[model samples]
Target chain A: MLFYDCSTAPNPRRARMFIAEKGVEVESRDISIAKGEQLQPAFRAVNSRATIPVLVTDEGTVLTENLGIAAYLEARFPEPPLMGRSADEKGLVLMWNAIAEQQGGAPVADALRNGHPAFKDRAIPGPANHAQIPELAQRGVARVAQFFDLLEERLNESPFIACDHFTLADISTFVFVDFARVIKMRVPEGNTATRAWYEAIKARPSAQI
Target chain B: MLFYDCSTAPNPRRARMFIAEKGVEVESRDISIAKGEQLQPAFRAVNSRATIPVLVTDEGTVLTENLGIAAYLEARFPEPPLMGRSADEKGLVLMWNAIAEQQGGAPVADALRNGHPAFKDRAIPGPANHAQIPELAQRGVARVAQFFDLLEERLNESPFIACDHFTLADISTFVFVDFARVIKMRVPEGNTATRAWYEAIKARPSAQI
Candidate 1:
């Protein structure tokens, strides 16, 4: 399998951290986003969407999204299951992972893309150029602040984002929260539970990447 | 199993259609979003998110999102599978389902919520109130138009969104495309392939509910 990744991006980092946790050996090619490499014709040919963290399986099927990459990897390497073990667990894991993507990942992305000058005319993805909406940047920050509160609430009750164990939900949350640094946001200092959880995950060897 | 649903909502309709396809008997309770019933104390006690399409399993786990409900049902009833038949197939199904959610579902929602007077102070979900960004409404309309183009392109090459057989991916795409009506968006008249696929799914008996 071949993985197309960007060393600095959050979405790709989630996949990178996931692969590291799984101890999988796959060839990697880094596509630099800062250099606008993802928009290049070569990358577009690989994924017309021009997104990174794409996995080209041996069957030549190109998996374009983070969930796809995580799902395929979890299915292929079931030993250390980052997704979940039982039927109930799988459902909850997926639910929370989707929450992480939708609630956490998306807002962080909005704050970054809409506020950053580098992303002007590129707030949305794909082969399109959408001008940044300043109102969206403000909205995104407000949303992220609320998202942090929600995570703290969820993490306080459950040891992890989804449940008792570290799963893809945690991976997704960690990546998003870490990326929130770009927006000058972090877990509120008073959110002790979230801070503890963040520290624990940060100490993981997979997080070193 | 008990399903909490909103008849007019797309996400809930996704579960409704999936359950119909599976031919499973699930006791369902309607949570009316139009009346703001989801915000009531009783329903909030069930799903604090105030979102419908929640599945309360016999095991007493509340599956809150479309993916969670779908995963639980697919696992419990594996007949005429709407998820997928294999590991690779599952990955592809999820990938497309996510595309439908992010590209199709989200944009349609943005257009409706950000532009509609009824959704003022509710541009974003959850307990917090976010003011509508009129600019986001325009962005959403543009995004939905692009999403239609992408769907048309994909449908031209494949009979189904994910693969040969219908799966959750098809269910998500169908629901989102249908919900686009609320945003005054539909498949362009010239997009024969998308129109054909949409019409075929529209004929499904499950769609009637």
Candidate 2:
């Protein structure tokens, strides 16, 4: 199997951490997002969307999104199930992962892409260039603050993001929370539960990558 | 199982159609998004996110996102599988589904919410109110057109959005294509491949709902 990754990006890190947790050995190539390498013809041939964290299985099928990459890996390596064990658990894992994407990941991305000069005409990621909206950048910071509260509330009630055990939800949420630094956001000092959960996951071997 | 629905919304329709295709009997309650019923205290108690298409399982687990609801239902009823039959197919299903969401569904939503007067201070969905960005409205219209092209390209090569058989990807893409009407967007007349694919899915009994 072959993996297309971007070392500094949060989305790719989620896939990287998942692969590490599963103890899977796969060849990888990094396509630098910082250098605008993803928009070049070579990367576009691999994924027309020009996105990273793509997995090309032995069958030569290219999985372009994080959801697909993680789902395939979880299915292939069922020993240490990171998705979930039971039917309901599976549902919760996906649901919470969606929350992490929509609530946590999105606002952080918006704040960076819309507010940063480096992303002047690149508010949205893809093969195209989109102009940034200053209003969205301001709103993103506010929403990110709310995301921290949401995480704190959820973590206070449960040992992990989805349930008592570590799962895909934790991986997704952790990456987003950690990536919040790009927007000058962090788990608020008062959010003890979220802080504790973040510290615990930060200690994991898979997260070290 | 009890399902929370809003007949007029595209996201809720995705869940309704999935339930219909599965031929499962689920007790449902309509939450009028037009009436702002989702923001009511009662609805907020069920789903703090204040979104429609929530599923309260027989086990009393509340699923607030479409991904979670679909995953739970698919696991419970494996027949007429809407996800996929194989590992690669499953990955493709989700990958295309994400594309439909990011490229199709999101742009359509942004155009409508940012351009329509009815959505003033409601640019983003969920519990909070956010003002619209006119720049995003213009960008959304352009992106929606590109999304039609992307679908046309994919459909020309494959019968369905994901693979040989219909799956969750088709359902998501179909709903987004149909919802483009709200933003005054339609399948371009020259994109015959997309038109044919859209019409085929439109004929499905599940889509009629």
* Weakest 10 consecutive residues of candidate 1 chain A by summed lDDT: A82-91
Q: In terms of DockQ, which candidate is strongest?
A: 2
DockQ of 1: 0.70
Chain A TM-scores of each predicted structure, in the order given, are 0.98, 0.99
Estimate the overall C-alpha local distance difference test score of candidate 1: 0.88
Q: For residue B2, give model 1's deviation from the true position in Å.
A: 1.1
Mark the regions of model 2 whose C-alpha exceeds 4 Å error after superposition: none
Candidate 1 falls in which docking quality class?
medium
Residues B53-121 of candidate 1 have per-residue lDDT tens digits of: 798888898888888888778878889988777667777888899899989899888899999999999
- Per-residue CA lDDT of model 2 for B72-148, tens digit only, reads 98889999888877788888888898889889988888899999999999888899999988888898999999999
- C-alpha RMSD of candidate 2: 0.9
Per-residue lDDT of A1-209 in model 1, one digit per residue for the tens? 99999999999999899999999999999999999989999999999988888999888889988887887887788979887777677789888988888888898888889989999999987788999988888888888888898898898799998778999999999999999999999999999999999999999999998
